[model samples]
Target: MGPRFQNDDRVRLYREMYEQHGPIAPVVLPGDVPCWLVLGYRELHRITSDSALFSRDSGLWNQWPNIPADWPLLPMVGKQPSILYTVGERHHRRSALVSDALAAVDPFELRDRSERFADQLIDRLCGRGSADLIADYAKELPALVLAQLYGFSDQAGAELVPGINALVDGGPDALRGRDRVQAAMSGLLTSRREAPAAGVASRMLHHDYSSDFSFQEILEDMMVNFVAGHQPTADWIGNSLRLMLTDDRFAASLSGGRHSVAEAMNEVLWEDTPSQNIAGRWATRDTQLAGRHIAAGDLLMLSFAAANADPQVRPDRTSFTGGNSAFLSFGHGDHRCPYPAQDIAEGIARTGIEVLLDRLPDVELAVSAHALVWRSSPFLRGLASLPVRFTPTPTSAAGVYR
Candidate 1:
């Protein structure tokens, strides 16, 4: 049986193990499932790449009656089988759809939209002297962008934010929130089917798949995409902003105007990686990894957080700067995350940051940096709250984007 540890202790132990052991370590999960936590850069790459040896299907979790069946919010966003969770030819086809959508969209247009969103947010918070960065800025920005892409009305988009938060946080409250979000999404899916709009949901609805995706399948896809799309981006923005504020060198990099804020943002994604712990995978056959013996049917967890810090892969790894390209926050190989298109999302996120920095270069943290609370979840990583103080920028004469 797996040794029991408090959530806090487990997280601490995981971090310590990474520091002490290099990469792979033994982890005792609930129910005593003997598992190997892959923390090394190369090991993570190997484990995620060998689809034949590892399975993404939640067969083990699905069989557990106590766990919520509707836990994963993937099925409701698109018709594709969440490229991150499937294997073989199906995975290929699903990935192609996501790639094609990103490729079809104009990059400059997306960046402009991001800049406008950032301008509006800064207008609201700048000079206000105090704001909860998570609520006032980070959370809302990504939710709005995703909503716009999905053709949701502002009101509908607003309604879903709390629900998304609950789902990502995961607990008793999360179950309740999931129910609310699922219902809302179900209704929206039905309405869209009746009156399709020219957005992502509409595109998914009209996708010319060889096999027709069922209504439930479409709903599942939406859930995954919506939750994945917003939560992590929100976490990234909040965390990156906090880091930049605290680290003079990183902040200077942004304000110096020499290294474009865009490059700095890429460094953030590569370094911080909001999705700290990816979902568990089951091994199909005994496999050797990092000289450890593996048994078939054992569980394996990938720690992107740990991998991003590995010195072998990210040679210059540091807290503020370094370890950019080596970070595999997004899983590698066939099951890599397909949304927010790194190029597009990074551009959009950076454009927003650039606008904010341009307007409020002196913005600083309202609360002590150490006082900020880190959110706890086995699946995600981010701030629970970020209180910041800054002078508000004057509202642009231009109207907000509809």
Candidate 2:
């Protein structure tokens, strides 16, 4: 599929694939890379949870040799030393280190700081009576917040966010973005090692980490956190606001005092998960997934958006408010986001969204929801921009969005 069709209207294409191929469908991506996509919620859970049958190791993938070098699939399916790319004990060790490091962060601190960032961004353009929520608000809040959590110097966030954004975009600029991420991580790691600052890198170095990680491995781990935290979280916030701005029932509920920001966040998770499709995983052995024939070392993808909207699994079409926990948006099994840590992430999002809604209660979409642009990535789902208008709110001496 071309970039425009794959990104803007993929939800419809996914439904078509499901109708023809059922739970598991075989399709080729932009570079003619063939892989199976799991559309059924139950089937996706089975493949993702049962890691023994579906390995996350891209090295086991036999398709790489056949694929061309400049296929634009390397960033997603390529080998890496991070927990995201590793399997088995290595996965466990890296996960432990990350979990411990995230645990060290105070959630309250995160919420407070995130509000400050949101307020600061909003302050920049609040008085102008217009805002591109995606650019002014949604983009940098998560970027800077994640930078802080990842232990990078807060000053570097402006440079760091866009580079990582390129990495996750999964296009021609992806490899370039990957290089920036590595260099940025190296700079931060070397700085942290010498000065010994506070964050994931600091804790990872001093804590009783489960795995003996090399410096490069540590850099990869930092990339994983920043990548995981940045776009997806930003999209979650943007999509949640889009929902609140576009859906009448949703907007009424939230504005009419019937719904909570947490519910809105979950609603986005349930239906419009940030990473609509995950382009990793390979068959460990010859097997039948959901009664479909599959060979060993076959590349696979999980359609989290499709799976969450499965009619058989989730029949309730009434509301997207209270999201189900079973959604594969954040994934499951060994590689899924851990508890409380996941809660912390959601809290940051909720706080960020709440800050905007409360500050700019009269804000309305400047364009039709259907007119918004989505980023062209094989895996991620993000709005290109969310233009919004709000009545100018006066800023006080305390420097709030008013």
TM-score of each: 0.84, 0.91
Specify the poorest-scoring 10-residue window by lDDT in model 2: 252-261
Off by over 4 Å in 1: 1-22, 60-84, 253-260, 315-324, 398-402
Clashing pairs in 2: none
What are the lDDT scores of the predictions, listed in order? 0.67, 0.77
**lDDT, candidate 2, at 168:** 69
Candidate 2: lDDT of 307?
90
Evaluated at residue 84, the lDDT of candidate 1 is 54
Over 1-402, each residue of candidate 2 has an lDDT whose tens digit, in order, gives: 465445645666766777888888988876677888888988888887888989998888878788777766676778766778888887787788878888878878888778877777778787989989887877778878877777776577767777877776666897798898789888878887778877877877766763388887877777777778777888998988888888775665445343566677787888678878886679989998767889999988878888987767766646554645667788888878766467667877888888787778888989987788877666777788999988998763437432
C-alpha RMSD values across all candidates: 4.6, 2.7
